[model samples]
Every structure is written in structure tokens, then in C-alpha cells.
Target: MSSNPASTPPPPNRTSGDRDATQPQETAEREINPERDHRCESRRGGTVIIEGGTVVTVDDSGTEFGEGHVVVEGDRIVAVGPGSAPAQQGPVRRIDASGCLVTPGLINTHHHLYQWATRGYAADATLFGWLTELYPVWAGIDEEITHAAASAGLARMALSGCTTAADHHYVFPRGGGDVFGAVVAAAERIGVRLHAVRGSMDRGRSHGGLPPDSVVEDLDAALAGTQEAIDRFHDPNPGAQVRVAVGPCSPFSVSTDLMRQAAELARRNGVRLHTHLAETTDEEEQCRAEYGRTPVEYADDLGWLGPDVWLAHTIHLSEEGIARLGETGTGAAHCPTSNGRLGAGIAPVRPLLDAGAPVGLGVDGVASNEAGGLGEEMHQALLTARARYGPEALSVRDALRLATRGGARCLGRDDELGSLEHGKLADIAVWRLGGIDHTGIADPVAALVLGRLPKLERLLRGGSVVVDDGRLMPVSEAELTHELDRASARIRTREVSA
Candidate 1:
């Protein structure tokens, strides 16, 4: 990567009184006029000028502006520079981001939105044990339950500053009534971009798999459902609100035939492939016992290693597996918090980045990682990497990049959604760092990644405000909470009756 002209070295720490001296002239000039600003009003197809903030682009050159501005025209970023935006001709919505950090909206590379209703169960269980305990409960989910759970999950993600999320929904119970479509509907309702991976599991205990037979699909049914999802929701166009991917759940729960066929199906439709791989030693042992090879080698044999593929967890990869993934341009979703919760070993994030593999952070699932917020993943990833490797294994900027650019690479949306650059979608996040939690932090990026996750001031998705001033704009939190409670109770009731 080349050097960025706007980039600046980390500033010296200062008292709250001295912080104002660091502001640029343009930033100091702008003041909030509630009547004129209309801070969080809808911005569809309009010009939005956000100035007076620390701008971290996370672009190829690692651009950082001490105090800068971003101009959004309609759904795309029109300009980004070191000072206030140039004058605009028509009526414009001006945001006085005087004490905020502006950057590209965070992307979540992996999640299980449907698991939101299943949190707090199997809290002390290992990966396999947790799956065993939850499979029966998940077998009762219908389209209504899935919609409620996914809506609550996505609302939490938006509150945490994520603009785009990739949800891997694999559990399809009998007579679920379009459970996959419910996930898509929840994304639309929440107003965030969705990479809905139509995941399938075909192997059951009868076939030596982890999940029960009731939760598994037949081979033909799984393929047909995946194809239907793609035909209904996959959008190849840029700035798409929803896209579909093919995912056969995991090596332990999905048959060999399903895995190979799913990969072929994804490639045929020009969509991406995702799955769980090398997440635990148990999974590695199971793969070796069944296929006489490591997880990565088995995937390689099935043509699952490529740029269009990203595997989740990836905590137990061998050095050779890591090298192969890098050489093949495969992506990895590093879920640091979830790994630590399940006692899974730390993922080789630094090694993966060094070997040219794209690595992004993930909040694996609320079931294991109860918090399920994407912002804190950066902090967890940094500490875990340094604790396992060395202090220099990851940096604050590197962690931020993992959430933004690296995630885009994993989801194959690097061209449109990652960085704050011209011609890119206006999916931006403004975090308020002037509060007590982040007031004294000198470097804004460090304040964001190293300190507690700052309160989100505003989150724009495709130039529309989804979260404003730490509140969700599209739906009520109380409503989602109520619906989630009902969904959890319904699933639990079905389990009890069975």
C-alpha cells in the first residue's frame, strides 16, 4: 500500500481543556443549529455534509485525517478531504460532527441471527456440546420466530455501528414456512445490508453427525432450497440491499456430497461460498477420522478453497492449512470473543494477514457470544492476538481495518462498501468520542478501538440514517425485545412438549 497524504501520526495525549486546540479551523467554525441541521432526518437522494471529525478511511493507503469532512450526494460518497467540504449549490443537510470519529460503517463477516433466541443456553459447554444441546430447540423455529429473532439481532448490530452483516442460517426444520425468507425480511425491516448465506446441514446422528435427524435436510431438498434462495434474493448489482451465498453448515454436520455440490452451485451463480471450518480440535479430529485429511485439505479436495470463499471461526488451522488458505486467497472470519468463550484456541490472525489471506472479525453467534456486538470484536481481536502472539501482533488501526476493509474483502464487497472513498456507497459511522469514556484519548482511532466502544452518533446506510444518536430509527427496541421474548418462549415450549 502507498502512503496517504492526509494521514497523520498519533497525536499526544491532552487534558479535556486542551482538546479544542487540536480541532481544524473548519471544525471550529461549524456549530449545531437544530432547526437548520435536522441532524438525524432521512437523507434519501440528498446532499449530506459531515465535517469537524476525525476521519479514518481505512482505505488501501490507510488514510487518516486529524479533522476532516465527507460529502455524500445521494447514496454515494462524493468527496473526502482534510477540511470542510466545498460549497454546495442546493439545500444541504449539514452535520456538525465536532467531536466525533467518522469512518466507514463496520461490516460483520459472520453471524447466526436466528440464534438470538437461543442465547444463555449451553453457556459452559464445548462447541459440540453446545450444538447438541441447542439443535433440538432450534428445530421448532418457524418463519415468525425467525423473523422476530433476526429482527432483534440486526437491531443490536445496527446499534453497534454495523451497516452490513452476513448471516449464515443453516437450520431448516420441517414445515418451517420459509424460515430463510424470514431472515431476509428482518434485514429489510432493520434497514441494513444482508449477505444471507442459505446454509444447509444434511448429515445427522444416523450418518455420524452432530445435529439430530429432524434438523437436517435431505440432499435434494437442501440443494433445491439453496437454489430457490439464490433465485429469489441474490443480487449481482452494486449497492444491493440483499445478496445470497451458498453454505453447507460444516464438515461435521454436512455430508461430503452436499459440501461439494454447494460449492459448485455457488460458483455457477457467481455467488460466494461460506462455511465453518477448523473451528475446533474436535472438528479437525472428526474430519481426519472420516476423510483421512485435515479440514483444509478436505475442503481443498472438494474445490472449496478460493477467493470467492470465506470460512468462519478457523481457530484450529495448521501452519500448512494457513499457507494454503493464503495461497488460494481464501478469507477467514476471526470470532475472538466466541472462541474465548468456548475455550477454542486463538486464530492465527497475524499469520493469516502476513500470508496475504483476508481476515475479518465476526460475532459468531449470540448463543455463544451473548453480547453479539460487532464493535467490541475489534478490541477482543487485538487483545487475543497480542496475548497469543506478541504486543505487535495487532495494532489499533489493524483492528479497525479488520472490521471495515478486511470484512469487505471477506464478503467480496471491497469495491463498494469498505472504505470512505469517492464513488463508494455512503455507509458511514460517526462515533461520539467527546464523552467521559473517550474524552482524553488523544488518537481518535485508538480511542475507538482500544477504549470502550464509543456511543454511535449516527449510522448511515446507503445515505439513509438507520441509527441516530445511539437510537435505532427503523424500529423500536422495546418492540423487538418483546417479540424476542415471545419467540424464545415459543421455541422453549415446543421443546418441552416434545
Candidate 2:
């Protein structure tokens, strides 16, 4: 097979995570490298053939699997074919995937992982009302609370097969906690490939935004903080485990001048940009009232429309807006779970895809969805798309692609993290398909996407196991539960005070 890339990220260096998992073309003593082999502690030569499952390869042609086997030599997928035997003379680690489906690791295009603590607080309210209720709780946050929340949220995503995620966390309560940096640290420790968008909001209630006074930043302070975070944590490598993007809150919550300034900073610093756009009617109303333009037009005017930018919950886009997004190559993160829970209108996903706009799936903030699992988001995405179109319009295959390839495109990281091809990073998830929901189904991918909240079997990033048997491998479940409870108790008392 040719080694030409199907979809690649723009020029930056590829990092360690993008290590080619394929076997080399030699009987070869020349293959040994101290840095890659000795320092990394990675195994070589042995093959891991996942046989017995239908492979859901979301490639250019679409889902095509006929009783295939994926040969993993080292950490990357070397060859995928019809249950082929390992041609080389080495021990093969075989996995029974006969009834299961082999898919790329799911990707979360946008999230606020720290918002897990805010769940169930304003369950029945609209977006703005809900934000108003939860912002104070968020404003009073410390590093301990925010880190725990981020860690817990990432652990949940890992257990659900999300190998990669982008988080847009815009809250900055003044305690020198560095919420954005802490989130990056949490994701790294948990072994999830993360793009931490250094998010900021400069407009408080005094500035006609919904957020409280304590959490908002000054415009210059926001830009400086973002720059510092990016310089410290953002890796411009292909296989980088951690990357930083700039997120200047949303249309209503930040000034237009700040938005443009943030975009310029991102381009100058060589990173990406993200934000919340057209999520609800209130946002649309604000854009119309304040900017005298639709949300899309306003974003375009602020220099926020481009391939490097991805907006969350673009559910309220007009026809002209859709065309503009298509023309500009901007991306959208379709948060089906949040949309359904909040009664936000279903996004026109069909039209967006048809128009050549990049659209990916996000679980959104747990406060809105009550849970953040990539697999659950996949289920929600397909269900929501089927609701908007016919059941057949958005297939289980398409939904999976949105979580993997589609998301990579949104983050402008398609070259490195999206697929299970030869050169792509060995970021993967394995699901054990053995229960009532998966039993009668012949296709495991179908069962996975359609099943009623099935557990994620395992998750691997950079060929390292982060989640094993439905639990985070590094941390104890009991300890996690205890910390979660303790954190909840403290936050509960604080909420009562507020």
C-alpha cells in the first residue's frame, strides 16, 4: 500500500505520539534507535492482529469491512486486510474481534471538562439562564476543585473511547489557579490527547454579558494569559500530546475587538482558535442587537472565520451563515446531547456537511448534558441527525467518522490523530462487545453506536493504556469516588452560601 497521507495537519513538527506503528521494511539491525526504542520503552517487531471483528475503517470510500484483521507492529497499524497472517517470524498478540468492530478512537471537538461539578444545578433551564445559575459556582473555583473536575471528566471520556479531545474552558475566577493550564496537566496525566483552548471571557454582567463580575478578565489580561499558556504548554509537534488553542469566549460574552485580537495572537503564535457560536436563540438575539449582524457574519467580521477556528454548538446558523462557513472552511462542533437536553433546535448537520463545512461531535459541558462520554455523544449525534433527516441520512459509520476524522479536521490535526492508518499515532480504543445490547447485532460498530449506553472497554493513547476494563488504569475507582464526593460536598456548601 502507498504511504501517502489521506488527510494531514499543516506544518508544525510531528511529536512522539505520531510514532509510526507499522513494522519496518528490513530483516533489520538498522531499526534500533536509543531515543525511540530505549527511552520510550516501546515494544517492537511483534504483531497484534485483531481478528474476528468487522473493521469500521472510516476512510475515503466509507465503511468497508469483510472479516478483516489489523496488524499492529509496534504502536501503529502496519497492515489491515482479510484476516491475514503475520508474514514476519515473531510472536503475534491476537485479539478476538470477530463479533466486535474495530474503529478509530473517538474525538471530542469541544468541551468544558471542569463544568462536571456544575451538573444537575439548572437542569430544566435554557442556555443563558443555566449559565447564570452556574457561573457563580464556577467563579468561586480553586485549582483543586477545577483540576479534580477536569481529571474526572477526562477519565469519563477515556472510559467511553475518546482518545482525543479539545476543551474550551473560559472561566477564570481570580485566585491565581490557572484553570486552563491545570486542565492540560490533568489530560496529560490521564493519557488523553488534548488540545486545551486557553479560553477567556472579558465581559461580565456590567459589560452586558451573563457571567459574574469575579470571573471576567480585562482584554489585555486575557490575551497575555493566553499567550503565556500557549508558550508554556503548547507543543507544535505532529504527535504532541498537549496543544494550546485560543478561545475568546463567545459573541455576547466578549468584545468584537478582543475577538480579532485573540485571532491575531493565535496566528502569530502559530496555534488554533476556538469559541462558542450560535448555540442558542439568546446568542443570536445578542449578535443581532449588539453587532447588527447574524452570529456567523459577526464572527467573520471579527477575523474568527477560518480553518484554524472551530465553533461549538452551531445549531442556529442561517443559510448565508452556512455558505460563509463553507466558503471559509470554518469548523463546527455539534453537541447533540446538550442540544437535546436544553431543547436547542437541532443543527442542520446535513446541510453543513453537504456544503463542505467541517462538523464534528462534542459532548459539551457535563452541566448541560449531565455526562460527558464520547460514545454517548456518538449515540446522541446519530439519533439527532436521524431526527433532522431520515434515519438513513446519518449512518452509524458517519457518526463514528465525526468523532474521529471529523474532529481531527476541526482541530486542524487530521494528519496526526484522526485515523488508524499506518503512519497515524496509535491512539486507539478497544470495546469488548459481549452483552445484551451487543449480543444479537452482527455489526459491532452498529451495536456500539446504537447500543443503549455501553461501557468503553479500553482506551489507549500513544500506545499507552490509560483506561483498562472500564476504569482508569492509573487511578483507583474508590479514590476517584471519594475525591468526587468530597469535592461535591465542599461545592454544595459554597453554592448554598452564594
Cα RMSD of all models vs. native, in order, equals 3.4, 7.5
In candidate 2, residue 377 scores what lDDT? Answer: 83
The superposed Cα distance between candidate 2 and the true structure at residue 59, in angstroms, equals: 1.1
Clashing pairs in 1: none
- Model 1 spans > 4 angstroms off: 1-8, 11-40
lDDT of each: 0.88, 0.76
TM-score of predicted model 2? 0.88
Residue ranges of candidate 2 with Cα displaced over 4 Å: 1-47, 89-92
lDDT (10s digit) by residue, model 2, range 22-103? 4334232212232332322223335555544556566665534545656666567777665433445655555444344567
Q: What is the model-wide C-alpha lDDT for candidate 2?
A: 0.76
lDDT of 2 at 479: 72
**Which candidate number maximizes lDDT?**
1
TM-score of each: 0.94, 0.88
lDDT of 1 by residue, 310-422 (tens): 99988888899999999999999999999999998899998899888999989988999999899999999999999989988888888888999999999999999889999
